[model samples]
Target: MRALTVKQPWADAIAHGEKRIENRTRPIPPKHLGTTILIHAGATEDFNALPADMVRAWPKDVRAVVALATLAGCHKAAKPRCCAPWGFPDTWHWELKDIRPIPHPPRPVRGQLGLWTVDDDTLAAVQRQISIERTSA
Candidate 1:
């Protein structure tokens, strides 16, 4: 299983299905996609100006929560334009469907991107139930 580390609120939004875009680079090529991916809810640099669509769908009780979500699909945000740049677009959008709050993740790192492989035990730790108490702190 390949786990992806994502920033804060976006991770939370993904967990609740409010946000579809991971808002960063693709962890790996579309082919490298393995059996499952873990959603690492770490901190993000910017305060999302949050789009209108996001605000409408965002869980009302949500507060800077981080969650682990399984990947469903990865697609381009829009048609790739010709005049952009040398490399792929700065943003590689991902769809987060099966999302759950990861209570405690090991080596919880903070960054915009990184895809690493994890074993069964780590997977179990991620799948463990989270006590969703209180609103965002």
Candidate 2:
């Protein structure tokens, strides 16, 4: 599937489920299109953009975006995504049913909170959806 290449912490957050808003200069594509694979793109560029305050809070923690997802029909945010859930509780707050890790696990997921993908099969499904939506519009 098309990848969103999130940084370390943010990618970890999504994989683990701890962060809510995957803050970005460019917002995730609006929900107007068909379902796109929530790729936990591994760290690409170092998160030098992390605010000083955030760094102070999370000294070792890294930040990446694309972990946050809208529960398909529901707009409520699911639980934060990260191996370390920080100090927060891990609960399915939203209705996100299908979550697939496009690439192989950078690390163990601990538990399969959502669907996981490591190849083109699942990615194709999301890709098809994206293509359909793009053409529809």
Candidate 3:
């Protein structure tokens, strides 16, 4: 599966269904639309950089794929609107849906820019985790 590395708080927010739109400086490729992708939490964190309210809800895990979400669509934002709460002017907003957390990620992996492929072993592990989550639920 393809994955995107997003910074903390935002990644956590998306995983927990708190954020529905991901703001990007550039648009995602058209082919990615309607695709299910892994949501990788980046390794870096700057608690001081985030707003106080956001810092309170931050997830502890970093440098791992925390969730899976469908890339519902990508749109160009003419201005800051309801879709993206932290959106910047003229940025691309990627709509995400069906966000589900992995609970315990299979393993940690370094993140990269754009959409990157997940290794088979890791993907299988993630699938196992998903299976466990479903059965338990």
Top-lDDT structure, candidate number: 3
Give me the runs in candidate 3 sitting further than 4 Å from their true place: 49-58, 80-84, 131-137
Task: Report backbone clashes per prediction.
Answer: 1, 14, 0
lDDT of 3 by residue, 28-61 (tens): 7877778888999888866565567776765647
lDDT of 2 at 82: 33
lDDT of 2 by residue, 1-137 (tens): 23344465555445544454333333234542234435354434344544455444432322222332333322323355432333223322222323433223323222122333334553354454432232211
Instruction: Give the residue spans of candidate 2 off by over 4 A.
Output: 31-34, 44-137
lDDT values, one for every candidate: 0.50, 0.37, 0.77
Model 1, C-alpha of 11: deviation from truth (Å)? 1.3
Off by over 4 Å in 1: 26-28, 32-34, 44-66, 79-90, 103-112, 118-124, 130-137
